[model samples]
Target chain A: MKKVLLSTLLVSLLAACAGQDVKDQPQAAVEDRAAAQTQAGADAKPTGQQSVTANPLKDPSNILSKRSVYYDLDKSDVKAEYKPMVEAHSKYLTSHKDAKVAVQGNTDERGSHEYNIALGNRRADSVKNMMNVYGVPNSQIETVSFGEEKPRATCHDESCWKENRRSDIVYQGE
Target chain B: MIFRKLLVGAAWLLLAPLAHAALTIEIVGSGANQIPISVVPFAGENALPQGITAVIAADLQRSGLFKIVDPAGVRPEPHELAEVNYPDWRTRGADALAVGSALPRSDGKLEVRFRLLDAVKQAQLDAYSYVIDRAQTRATAHKIADLIYEKLTGDVGVFSTRIAYIVKSRSHYELQVADADGYGAQTVLASKEPIISPSWSPNGAKLAYVSFERKKPIIYVQSLVSSQRQVLAQFKGNNSAPAWSPDGKQLAIVLTKDGSSQIYLINADGSGVKRLSYSSGIDTEPSFSPDGAAIIFTSDRGGSPQIYRMSVSGSGAQRLTFEGNYNVSPRFSPDGKSFTFIQRVSGSSFHVALQDLASGQMQVLTDTRMDEAPSFAPNGKMLLYATEIGGRGVLAAVSSDGRVKQRLSTQAGDVREPEWGPLLKN
Candidate 1:
């Protein structure tokens, strides 16, 4: 019985890890496709090695790649590293007319849950507004606040807090 | 020398019995009243784990303001706000009703959703959903109680908060953290010997507790998030009563490095150690004033454990509690205008008492047996403490006006030394 239980636990852990890997695949593809597009543009100017046409869906995984956007302590200002991913997502939403996504914001368990919920909503709204400005249709975006209810990491200090202060882009059903 | 001083104090106690009577008035004048309300069982497809509805109902019932109707008392089952018959509830004299439900989420967690409804109008006043781990079902119940309380009374709920307490399990004493209602309790640190004075950080992320895990009672700051811990101070003789500053920057703790248990301020990262008290007698329980300017602590320099206020920079020491012969663990309210401390009468049991700084008036908050470790809610409208109810150590809460009182108990061992953290930001 103990052996069975241990194996069951191990299998669940592995499944969770696999799910995380699957979540990372889209973003990885996005970077690869963007790099390939840049390389193709550079090659056309050089030795003229058969000018390649841009394949927008060369990496369909890029659609799912951008998973999260992080914020500073008590501040919802989007960081520079997340700008490209956000713009890419915005462009994708603009292209895919029927696609809808929900931005869920979260916080570390530092303050009152109510206050954190409000702060998380503000963060989600900020991201939604940014996407709208980037040409993503407002109808395609929905904002929700999970406050500190959902945490990627549960440590007490800044290490865990940095990870918890994030807004996740969850794709709505087709 | 300590034994001799105890003997002298005992002699004074025996000779001056009438001298202590004046202090008794501080607690006896407060009157108690019962507030009536109804908490209907939350609707759920599957019966929630660990009787969440019952726990929340009991919490409201014990608050003295609420009169929870027995489960058999309501005739027709009121599952949702729409299903609640207002005439049926109003005839039963229920001012409000709380309805809730729990659903299993895709993440293997349970999402317990609740809505508080006004019984007369049958309208939803507050609604919330709690995503809880499988192991934390009981905590979710307490959170529900906190939610309903806040909605009805317009006060911040303390149910979702955790209490750090010292418990003697088996032959060993351990420092433990449990839900404020004393459920889902687990030992944070255990020792073969003794552990005393567990203080929660202002952010509720870490705990500063005195543990004898190092053979001596030393103060250690342990993070609740990572389970990482480090000894803050292990001085020669005594290291006890670690109180976190409001800003989470400094910790006011008791250290005997100066040959006495004097108050000292150390950075939360454990540097810039400075003494705040130069008293001759043992001074302990140094709680920071809400504004962090002064500390209200227990000192025996006045021949007994009298509450004294001393500046954080170690100047302008003044006596705050003159009436009480034994007053310890003085915690300032969030507004810093009022303070709560344990007052031990000569013959009667120790009671939790609140002191108004502006008027110098005192009121007894608890009539229970041996109440101690009073901590204030972030709103300063309520206080939580540990008291012996029916010979068992349990956590309890009393409203600011002493009109509402509630007892919180757990399924496990007896809990002692309850500490409340600041109001968490959502």
Candidate 2:
């Protein structure tokens, strides 16, 4: 009985994908949303930048592969340690016009839901602004705040919270 | 097809067996003055699926204002005024006596007649008769509880009202509307993505909430009856924190298209967007006053997030909280005399706190840590909020006086973002 119930829930979860039934506005066909495959495509060949794109971003040795910037509690400023990584990704995106990045911000559950949303927005915007300073176009970047909803770590203490309060630069189609 | 199936499944709660994940409520701490009341089982209620007296007694007990005088194996249950049971109830220390009967007629309607009497004085306090559909047996019992609540304490009861909250189980989220007692929950919207910040329209016909299904935060207003929804705000950047005006004609939403998270006002139909706050920092979580003349929101304009109030015309901005550096999510009471918000105590833990507007006095209502989304009941007597209990999320309630705490737990995953719906209109 439990297995049947689980299977029914799984089928319903798969069937009720967003926008197929719920969305009212006609979703624009502006950009491709195959973010899951963007990494594989971008890693095959060198995207125009010099050393950053010379190797696959999936390569453990490349700094361009480092896409996350962690923040302090209740803070949104991008830290100095992640500047080189941001600049490397910025160089790669600026060199390749079609290489879009969606900077997603997250937070610990310490703050209110909506407040974390606002704070996460600031965190993502802070990274996007840094990339723009490195000569990336504003049009090439999209920022979304998960706002403690999508946490990388689940523990209630600071050890997990330190990992949750951060932003990730996700390449389009990846 | 899943949405259709869900619609059918959600509709089953009206008359079918209770859902598997039904909520169980636990109460602690009684009100300052507890009135002992005896609720005799309605004479013909045994024939119905549920006894009306049980629901009424549970409602009154959950409020922490009344103590139940359990009548077990008592013969000749009082069904009318001439039952002459005041002496029996008075000896049992019951100050008030409630007697009623439910009789189903041939027309398929249940005639519910009830009376509340002063047991000590042996006088009739109030009597009511409601003929409703059979499916409304539980609802009518709640109405009777409300009637009895008003008659005895002079304060309105919130048993008959509904509350909307988000229940997150695994990767899926369900927006559910349930009775104020945490029973009879019906899923309004189910999704795999996160849905938060549900704000009910003034009349309780519609709900405005932020959905992240679009991969970005967007505001949508959905009708409770039709299950149809419209994108209220799909602007560039973060579009979230949708709050309805008291008149339901306009909505206060937070948008980032203007460079930062700032509050903006738009019509109910998603037209006429107007920015109301200008802060280089963050400004979100807009809550309207009961009169809809002003809005109180959380802003970091003073270098730390604090509650601030501004008029609807975008004038007369003033800071309201000076105690905590992290006070956020402010909601005004029904009477607008005070507001409830989450205040971080000593910069460590969060607790639901009430603030008085006239004297600027603040009192923490909940002892639990990590309390957020403090929504006042329609009567301004209790507050519903989200808190973490034993590492699992649950919904809790605390009376405005800081007494009468309750824990409303679901058998399944966490329930968060509980908003008490307005009193329903006939």
Question: Which segments of candidate 2 are over 4 A away from where they belong?
Answer: A1-55, B1-30, B346-348
Q: What CAPRI class is candidate 1?
A: incorrect
Off by over 4 Å in 1: A1-174, B1-35, B70-76, B104-112, B129-137, B347-349, B377-382, B387-398, B403-407, B410-415
lDDT of candidate 1 vs native? 0.66
Model 2: per-residue Cα lDDT over B226-291, one tens digit each: 888888999998999999999899999999998889999999999999999987999999999999
TM-score of chain B of 1: 0.82
Q: Local error of candidate 1 at B342, Å?
A: 2.1
Whole-model Cα lDDT per candidate? 0.66, 0.81
Best by lDDT: 2
Please give, for residues A69-119, the per-residue lDDT of candidate 1 as tens digits.
Answer: 778866666766566666666766776777787777788754322234445
